[model samples]
Target: MIGFLWETFKIKCLGGLREEVAREVRRHLRTNSAIRNVPQPFGYRMLKRFYGKGGLLSFLLRYAGLYAIIMLGCAAIVSLFPNWVPKSGLNSDRLPDVQNVTSYFLAAQAVMIGLLFPVALGVISLITQREDASSTVSDLQVYYSESFAFGVGASGIALSIVLAIHVFWPAGYVLEYLGFSDAGTYFEVVLLIAHLLWLLVNFAALWYFLVTSLSFMRPAQRALMRRRYAALTAIPDYLTVHLLNHRYIVRLAAEIAKKVGWDKAKTALLFGGRLERGEVELNNKALSGQVLSNVWQKPLMWVIRRWLKRCNKVEGAVGSQPDLDFCPDFRRPLSDDGIICRRIGGIPLDKIERFVVGQSFRFKAKKP
Candidate 1:
């Protein structure tokens, strides 16, 4: 029973915890995808939602409320360390007061955030936009714009609260309430830690945001996309013409490949399972001819017969023999053989009696 419980904890409980964490991370990423699309800064969005642009007093009140909350939180934490408050006229050896210095530092941060906002917006504006609304490039635009605004706004808010604490009222009077040794020093230490952490996190975020933006302009990835989508440009504007030319789909595809400088082999591979570099998530669905399993054979045969009859390729014959017994590999479509599609594209077929077999044929079918 003990062993069973241990196994359950090891496999089920621990494993579930990891799975839950991963699921939550994915959910957060999806949430960020939406958040990134919101272009406005936090302050603007809040103002817009709660008060009209004309409400100047409401705007001031909003920040005042924010400051009040910050002070309450400070009091809450400070209350835990009862002796945190220093006595009045806590003499200092240095000429420059720490409170004044801290305020100046935080005020500088507020100014810096203000400066950073316009520059970030400008740099983001330089990102070339796609004409298509449903484009990955556009998605990136949304992500950068929203994240930048959020970062700047958050930095501004934090700076404001920190500045206010120093400038207006040093959080609750320094009284030895908790009576812990050097409680006043602990409070000063907390302030220093907060300052260091704020600088560290914000600067790191800024560097990361800028550096990652450079990787977005990948020329090779763009070229691959150009090759992929150049075919869409071939689409005729008229619906009737498009429908008529649908029969020539293969030829049209070939034309696109040729236009994009793909050879016959590369053309065959244009829609094949991912063989090209830089495919992040390649899906492996059946491409080209399907497996003729026992369950599928009868229905497939009927379809083939109907299609052949329509094409006038088969007539009233006594018996029509197809090499159904011969097996073609169906191990996986995204394997190395996937480049050949296991049908055509230079894949050879097994020969049965009176069957003609030669070089591998290229099958045009793609995964359904």
Candidate 2:
């Protein structure tokens, strides 16, 4: 019965999750546009990596596994030196400190969910209304951000259960039920330390959430976001059939994706990389749009791009094809619509590669 219930619950979280992520991506695009705000996880970006990756157990394993270690380390120290906590003044009935802290802790946890739930829903509703897959980069950001926010809310609920127990039930009784010969000094130290740690983590999450929320208002962030939004919305039109399947551009994209933060597998999945064969396939064009995101969108040398495209069609009739004639430029397309990324990545690594690096790697690396 327990197993059956667990399976049902897991499905609710995992089922159609990718589609939901897609919907969120669309929603966040609209929300950001209406407010001219940049949509990103910012402080919560770490959670973005696992957005649509798994179910509840995975979240607990990742999130709990991360936070639990701190509490466990504290517990281990208390266990190792049980005598460190003097039993003389210890109260066996309850830890009075817990009563004082539980209310605030529960409130903080509540705030985490409060902030996350609405953001997730807003993203969902906004995207649902517009339903545009054009702004793939912004959409992807919104999707992952929504998934991360909602996932945190799920875990916060579980933590709130513990917080609530402390509020309504005696901590000593709860500890006794948790297991032990008695509610002793060692447990007290571990419990108090754990409480403090949870408090700190909750506040930290709140800080990040608040910072992200306020980013919508900051003039600088909004201007930057406006520019990026212009870039993102233009990406899809450039992603027409030929560009979607371009091998070299795809490779350059995959390389940049690797340098940014995507694992080899994800990069392969996105750009369909095969370095040995020197071949590339664009598996997920939308994701590829994300790969090429944040570049300065502009039309650069459209006359040259069109002439090049036409010239390339008959290049075999020529004596030899120069790199300039064979290779394409992104500035024209992404800027004015010759292509979505007509060499916007800066001149160093073709066009999109440098943009991917600065956008994904440096931007995220600098994020606090």
Q: Candidate 1: count the clashes.
A: 16
TM-score of each: 0.34, 0.37
lDDT of 2 by residue, 177-269 (tens): 544324344545565566667556555655555554456345475455455544444432344323433533454344433433323431132
TM-score for candidate 1: 0.34
Clashes of 2: 18
Query: Candidate 1 residues 276-355, lDDT tens each?
Result: 33222211234334421111122222332343233234353213222111122322323432332122222122232112
What would the TM-score be for candidate 2 when compared with the true structure?
0.37
Maximum-lDDT candidate: 2
Q: What is the lDDT of residue 53 in candidate 1?
A: 23
Candidate number achieving the greatest TM-score relative to the actual structure = 2
